[model samples]
Target: MSSLTVLVIDDEPNLVRSIQFSLNDQNIGLHAAYSGNEGIKTFTTLAPDVVLLDLGLPDQSGLDVLAQLKALSPDTPVIMISAHGDTRTAVKAVKEGALDYITKPFDIDELELLIKRCGEQQRLSKELRFLRSKQIHTQRIIGNSHNIQQLREMIEQIGNSAAKTILISGQSGTGKALIARSLHDIRFNDAPFIEINCAALPEQLIEAELFGAERGAYTGSVQKRDGLISLADNGTLFLDEIGEMPLAIQAKLLTFLENRVYRSIGGGKERKANVVVIAATNKDLKEAVDAGAFRADLYYRLNVVPISAPALSDRTSDIALLVNFFSEQFAKQEGCKPPIWSDDVISQLKTYPWPGNIRELKNLVERITILYPGQTAMPKHLPNEYKQNPASSRTEDSNYSSVVENKERELILSALSQCGGRKGLAAEQLGISRHALKRRIQRLHIDL
Candidate 1:
C-alpha cells in the first residue's frame, strides 16, 4: 500500500515535533502548517487523506478553518486537537464537521490509531467511488453510427439539464433501459437508481408498488410500505415498458409528475418525493393514445425530452465493435480467452437483420465465447437463421427497408452538409472512404 498523507495545522512547534517523532515509524507523510490560511493552502495543494487541525490557531478560528476545509473536500476526515478541549468545545467542533476532538497531552498511541482508522476510511471511500465509476462505464451505450452518436449527445444534454420527465422510445431489446440508466448514472450516480418494469407487474398491484400502501390497505398489507417512487427520493426512478402501465395508474402518475406529490393506498395524508422519472417503452404510445388504451395528456407529459434508441439493423457499422466488446466481457467472466472474428464472420454479422437488436448480438457473442474459446469465429458457427437467409435477411421486411433507407439518406445528407458539400470530407466525417460514400449517395439517389 502507498503511504498515507496527514496534514497537521498547529502553531505549537513542540507538539508538531512530538507528532512527527511518534508517527515517524508509522510510514506516514506528515506536513505541518503554522496558521489557518497556510493550512488551507497546503490542504488545497496536497489534497491529503486526513487533517489534524488545532482549535487554537494564530491566524483564524479553528471552526472557520474546519468549515472551509469541508467546503473544499467534504470527504477528507478532519480531527481537531486543542489544549482547552472541554465537552462544550468538543461538541462545537464536531457540530462543525470535525471527525473527532482530541485534548492536549493526548496519548501518542491513541492518536496514531485514530490516524490509521481515518486513513483506512479514506482508502475505502476511494475504492467505492472507483467501483461506481467502473460500473457506469461498463453499462454505457455502445455504438458509433450517426443515430447512436446523436442519441448519446441527447443523453448528455438531458442528463445535465433539470428535466424531471424523460421518455425513451425504441424497439424491444434496442437498449431503452440502458439509455435510461446512462442518463441517471451521469448526473445522479451517488443517488438511488430504482427501476420498475410496468409490464412485469400485474395491473392490480402496480399502483401499490409505485405509490406505496398503508397498513391494512389490502389483504396482504400488514404494514406500511415504501413504494419505488418514495424509495427513489432525491434520485432517479426508471419505469421500463411504460406503455404497459394501466390507464388508471397513468392518471395517478401524471398527477405525481405535475406536482411531485402522492398519497399511499388507504392513507389520507399526502407525501412528496423529489424524483427524476425516466420512462422507456417499446410500444407506440401515440397509437395507444389514439386507441384510448393510453391517455394523451400523460403521454405528452412523459414525452418532455424524448430520445430514440436506434435498432441494431439501423447501425450495422457498429456490429463489429459490439461483437468485440461483448466477446471480451464474456471471456473475462468465463475465465477464457476472447474469440477472434474472421472476415467472413464479420461480413455475415453485418448483413443479418438483428430483429432482437443488441440483446441478440450480446447473447450470440456469449454463446460463442463459452463454446469456442481461443478460436476464430466463422459464419458456420452462427445460427441457421443468419446463414440460410443471409442475402434476404433485410429484403424480407419492406417496412424495415424503407426505414433503413430513410435513415441512411438522412445521415449521408447531414454529413455532406457538415463538410460543405465536399465528397471526400463528407466521407471522412461519416467514417467511410470516398468511393464508399459515392456508392451510397448513388444508391440513395441523394442530390448534391
Candidate 2:
C-alpha cells in the first residue's frame, strides 16, 4: 500500500515540505505543486489516488482546480484545505464535489486519517462495480421441472468423464451457452473456458485465428500471433454453430483433432494444442453428414458425449421462474423499480408458445418493464400477438376457426377492463392502433 500516490497543492513552500516530511513513509507517495496551473498538469500526468488541494493558490483559486480534476476523474477523492473558515464556502466546496475539507492548521495525524478513509471508499466502489458485472454470467439453471432436473443430472455425469469431446444439440435460444458454461464450471472452473461463434466468423480468417500464425506467415502478419486454441490449452474450447464451419476448414480441423497438432498458413512448424472441445449446434449434423457436408469422422469424434436441451414450449411450467429471474436481473440493470407480474399476466405468459425459447422470454420481460414502468404487468401491456389468444395455446387442435370467437371475445374484454372502459385506450392496448377505442368497442360489440 506504500505505493499509493497522493498529490498535494499549496502556494506555501514551507507547508509543502512539512507535509512531505510528515507523510513520506505512511503508505503514500507525495507529489507537490505550488500553483493551480502546475497542480492541474501534475494531476493529469500522475493520475493520483487522492488529491490534497489548498483553496488559495498563486496562479488560480483552488476551487477552479478542484472542479477541473473532478470533471476529469469523478472517482478520485479530492480533499480541500483552507485557512479562512466560512459555512458558505464549505457548503460551496461540497457542492463542487469536494470529498472533504480541512483547515490550514490541521494536525498531521488527522489529515492522514481522512486520506485513509477516502482510499477505503474508493476500493469499495470498485468492488461493487466488479460484482455487478460478474453476476450476469454467474447464474445457474433456474428451473425445478423434471425435464430440467434430468438435464442437470446428465450434465454432471458427462462433466465427470475424461472424454475430450462433447456435443450439445438444441434449438436456437434454448440456453445452449448456459449448458456449456455449466459443464465447464463443473469441471474446469479454475481453468479458462474460451468460446467462439463459428457462424459469426468469416471463413477466410477462421483458420489463422484458431491456430496461431508465425511472424511473416501472411501478407499482414507483422508479428507472431497466438490464436484462441493456444489460449485454451489445458482448458475447454466451445465452438458454437459448428455446422456453419466451411468444408475446407472442417477438413483441417478434423486433421488437428486426430493428431493434436496444426500448421499455420504460410508456416511449416506444427503447433501442438491440447484442448478439450465442446461443440454446439442447432442444425441437424447427422443430416449434414449424410449430405456429405459435415465430415462423418469429425461427427464421431464430437459424439463422445451428447446432450440435448429441451425447448421452452415443452416445459411451460418453468415460465414463471424464468420471468421472475429476468425481471430481477433487468431491474438491477435498469436501476428502476422492478415491476409486479399480476397472476393474470403470468397466466397469459404461460399460454403463449415461446418459439424463441429463453431468449424470447428475456426480451419480453424487458419490454414489459419498459411499458409498465412503475406499475404491475397486465394483459393489456402485452404486444398484439399474445393478447388472450386461446388458439395460440392449442397444442393438439389444428382447427383454427373453432377457437377464434372465444379468443376475440376474451381479448376485447381484457382490453376494455384494463383501459378503464375507455375505448381509445382499449383499442391502443389491443394493438388496433386505428380509430378511437370507442369505435373499437362498437365494432367488437362490447357492452363496455
User: How far is 256's C-alpha from truth in model 1 (Å)?
Assistant: 0.6
lDDT of 1: 0.82
Clashing residue pairs in all predictions, respectively, total 0, 2
Q: What tens-digit string does per-residue lDDT give for candidate 1 at 1-448? A: 4799999999998999999999998889899999999999999999999999988898998889999999999878888997863656765676556767778889999898778766755665564444345545323566557987788778888888999999999999999888888898778759999999999999879999999999999998999998999999999999999999999999999999999999989989999999999999999999999999999999999998999989899999878767877876786665444666765787788878888899988977976775455455778876565765665543444364465568678877988888889998776555445776787689778877
Off by over 4 Å in 1: 1-139, 391-448
Cα lDDT, model 2, residue 356: 80
**Over the full model, what C-alpha lDDT does candidate 2 score relative to the true structure?**
0.76
Candidate 2 C-alpha RMSD relative to the actual structure: 19.2
Task: TM-score each candidate.
Answer: 0.58, 0.57
Clashing pairs in 1: none
Query: For each candidate, what is the lDDT?
Result: 0.82, 0.76
Residue 296 lDDT in candidate 2: 91
**Total backbone clashes of candidate 1, pairs 3 or more residues apart or in separate chains:** 0
Could you tell me how far off, in angstroms, the CA of residue 427 lies in candidate 1 after the best superposition? 48
Could you say which candidate leads in TM-score? 1
